[model samples]
Target chain A: MLKNVFVLALIVVLTLPGCTMEKKEKEQGYTARDELLGTEIIINIKNSKEAPGACDDIFERIKQIQGKMTVHNIESEIAILNANAGVKKVSLSQDTYNVLQEALTLSSLTGGAFDPTVGPLVKLWGFDSKNFGVPTDKEIQDKLNLVDYRQLQIEKSRDTFMAMLPRDGQAVDLGGIAKGYAGDEAKRILLSHGIKQGIINLGGNIVAVGTKEGGSAWRVGIQNPLAPRGTFLGILQLKDKAVVTSGGYERYFYENGNRYHHIIDPQTGFPSESDLLSVTIIANQSLMSDALSTGVFVMGLYKGLELMEELEGVEAIFVTRDKKVFITSGIRDIFQLIDGDFSYEQYK
Target chain B: MTVILVMNNINKWITGGLIVLAGLSFIVLYIYQGSQDHGQPVLVIYKNGALYQKLNLTKDLHKEFNVTSGGHFNTIEIKGKAVRIKEADCPRKICVHTGWLHKPGQIAVCMPNRLKISIEGRSDNVDDISF
Candidate 1:
């Protein structure tokens, strides 16, 4: 009987750690995925009990945002605004106003390198329709005339906000910034539910709230542009931050052995021929990070690096065409280059 | 004196039993750990946010199948320990262009068709990936 007790006690002791580990994993949270804003979004919440309710609210909020901002939706505020271009000031929803405000700010900051008015160019290149082709110079030039962010006008009258496009053909496409806005909204929804630890991945725009379980920072990988989608060149350890990357590899088509990517340079009215293949922005807010990633990609390497350095609380990683990775000083330590093929250096 | 001798015999048997049991436990643990090291990767496919299929990469070597939904289809091929969308009816073909995904946390998504494929493993190196 005594030996039996001893054996049972030994078994309990041996399995105790495993049992507890399994319990901890179960408590780690809930993960759900859905298609939104023309991309896949995955939301992971650390609190299992609150995940279902919070995710429902988050997805609902995103759908509303998508409805208002999407140019494809004819009833969307953006499409209505486009229809009224050079005609009248259109009333805007608060969310639409806020996103447009941030987008315009980024436009001025990047000196139109990332124009919200690039909608005409986006359509001309068939990016919006996915009928990819290279447009003629005259066609591109005509679209370029209407692709000026300055023509986008926004005004406020007491509680109501309005926006207008001064030119008849000008239009606003929040494609560059909408997902980030959605991520921010999702983060807000999660936090409002008293859930502090979560990861919101809106397509590729990542917003990490708090840290992983055990107070460890969330590890986010940066895609290696030259390799397949899942391949990562480096990882960023982040907490309460947003990471956004814009690359030619994301959306492009081949024509005459040359690639025509989706990210068009407002200046050239063609796919950006920037020396860098991708630009990743790490910032406090996803909206800023998303817009800046596109803006910096258009700005090229030297100018992009300068802009990132000048901005407070903003850091960037530029993967150049030569397979060299350049990171801002702030992210130098946290960004780990795991891939050996690419060499990294801190932008002095 | 007789009781003392019996007590000694009982102690010897108990100790011997414990040693054997401990040895057996250790051997069992070793095998469990070894099996874990050889844990097979799984290809988890989701269509319209619902689990469509789960394929064992090792066992499904060179298996080719088609996943169709809403008149859209993607041809999935499992080669060795990797899986990829060999062909997709989606216009952009981004899912096909994503190439093969073998490691945990690697995912290929066809947004137009609402189809997603990922290799599921025990643990992933990163919480998420930004592209």
Candidate 2:
């Protein structure tokens, strides 16, 4: 009897760890990181045998999109379009045309606050180069003349799509929207690979594909713009959604006692002087969140809040310069304010 | 009758010993589970998409090392539970400027050299951050 009891106890003790090991194997996750579109891209997928191959496919797709849309690459289609401005209508790839269509739609929706033709102003402000300086008022006024999104003409005839800038100086820069589009594309790739749980982070634009392991919502932190990177003002419980933030803190230069940021307002031709320091948008699609974050940041707090309330399935969190945090009604429950220094309020 | 009584006493002793043994094993399992750091953080370094090194941050130690790739080098320093890129030959020095990183999910990257250093642990409060 004693021998039988000892043997049974030993079996139970030994099998416990084995059971846990099997559970661990089932929850295995794979992560890969690469540099694409001039930023760090990290893709993490859980419990998928095709993760590595899927990540490769996703990166390849993003690189192909970058080749067509990046203004930094002279051979890119966007660069060619900029070069041939007012001279001829340049043919566009399907991907580029689709992204442009989204950009234009966002521009109209935001009432020109998120214009795609702000490239000349981006260059004149030295954001495209290492020389960061404050441009003169006259220079900004001249660049603003070329910053209109309406001047960009897109024509689609049956199978062919062509785009042209009606003026020589006008150019289109998709820097604000391309990363979000790439993130959306990555999520599609992950889903196609049977990866139900994943996180796609293109720089700071995040696309949470599904609930985390065990069906818990993924916790995504919102950056504290006033503090250094990695510090968060709050966390959002997200599943099958995208979050994109626009802030002047990302790129800026200090000249004398003033600071100039990179998000040039199409109307003012200057870094946005909006009362809010940062704006974050969350939606079902990364492309919408990405473009709307920029436009809302430039639109200021009240107007931006109004826009958020009007839009369905779109939520926003705005951090004002005075350290007031405001969230749209939709995200009031999901967003948890972690930082005590900032006061949180839900906009009516 | 004496033999029967002796056998009964022996069975009781055996049953008591078995209960004590099972109880001890359960206590040991509980301690083992408590000691396990399920979410212990780790510092991971990647060079050109391949994992270069992984260090257990729970260990108390101070160390510095140089990682060279393609004729370029970055000096990484680890102190206590934190890590940082102390120096690098890259022109921008963006990685070095990133400063110390101690929390899980924090990352510093040297894009020119294709080197990235990040803290990763299952115990992270947030999976990713949006800026």
Candidate 3:
């Protein structure tokens, strides 16, 4: 009887907190894992128990949602709807409808700066899987006729959309804003499932939820635009904040020693010619951060800061062609300029 | 007697497990800190252009490299082991203000006349690729 009692006590002692038993789980938890999203989508999330599975779940959801929304996939609802162009109405899933509605609203807010209807121009530039060489001015002009957000109508009441594209084939690609929106959704899903502290880095768009272990803010390093890799211009402390950087170096084909990137200006229908090398936007919303990073990069310095100041919670860091750093007032306090070539200038 | 014997063995095992865990934790901490360094060579700036500090792959501090007159303000060249900064004509001493490159991908710059000191490391295809 005494032996059994001692055994019971031993089990309790081993299972209790601060136990020296080797098999005992540590109070402090750490995890790291990779999540594959479709063919191209892969996101890594580091957290406690909810990490590995949550990351995988988020990627799976992204694939499922992308499959439904991608214009490239003929079987996708978006492609099928676009195939029957000049239609009266086409119904969409809630997720698709939500993304489109948000894109339209962002388009209005940025004054067509963040238009989803830019797909026509994207394809014309051959950035569409083919990445065909630059298009002629006349060809771009012909395609530009069908690339207006005002023409694309969204009826939120019925979750249906209608777009008026030319016969030459005007496509509406939500590629720019979709990834960010998906990141935001993935975070929301993770949080709902009791996973609090983590970061979702989708390409260059990063979202941090909650603080690190021991209640430390997540230290996020922004990449140096000119530097190749693992080189940071500075570090920012993100506490439940989403940061998205749009740079001239993210994607481009170099021919004859000249670099051509993915982010194209709608007005000229070519790569943006702003002095800014990259723009990183920090906000509570991932979609907004994503949308604004691209929009503000195209807006350049003056107008970009103006927009940053007008918005209550938006902060931006801009690196110009002259290697000068420009950041908004709010951003200056949070940003630590570690080793950039130039001092940071606050553009009113 | 049996209980006492078993208890002694259990206590020994517990202590052994704890020592093992403490050692493992220490090793883990060391690795984490080591990986974080990221292999950036350190370059410390000093007066006279003749005096400077250079840290190699092992990060062993080796101060005072031989300065050669390269016409530019203290130019630090990392050919094999030695690094030298050339002549500096600037009166403000801005080049001397920029410090060492401890992180793998970090770069220090003196923009007055375009002088760049950087740590060059192999690119690890990181997701975000932050500095």
Give each prediction's DockQ, rounded to 2 decimals.
Answer: 0.49, 0.37, 0.10
Top-scoring candidate (DockQ): 1
CAPRI quality level assigned to candidate 3 from its DockQ score: incorrect
Candidate 1 residue-wise lDDT, A204-313, digit = tens? 88999999878999999999898777678899999899999999999887777787889999898999999999999999999999999999999999999999999999
Worst 10 residues of 1 chain A by lDDT: A13-22
lDDT-based ranking: 1, 2, 3
Model 2, A101: alpha-carbon shift in Å?
1.0
Report lDDT (Cα) of residue A302, candidate 1. Answer: 95
Q: Please give the TM-score of chain B in predicted model 1.
A: 0.80
At residue A307, candidate 3 shows an lDDT of 85
Give native contacts recovered, as a fraction, per prediction.
0.64, 0.51, 0.19
TM-score of 2: 0.84
What DockQ was computed for model 2?
0.37
Interface alpha-carbon RMSD, every candidate: 4.0, 4.9, 12.0
Ranked by DockQ from best down, the candidates are 1, 2, 3
Model 1: lDDT equals 0.88
**Per-model chain A TM:** 0.94, 0.93, 0.85
What pairs collide in candidate 3?
A231-B131, A232-B131, B73-B87, B74-B85, B74-B86, B75-B84, B75-B85, B75-B86
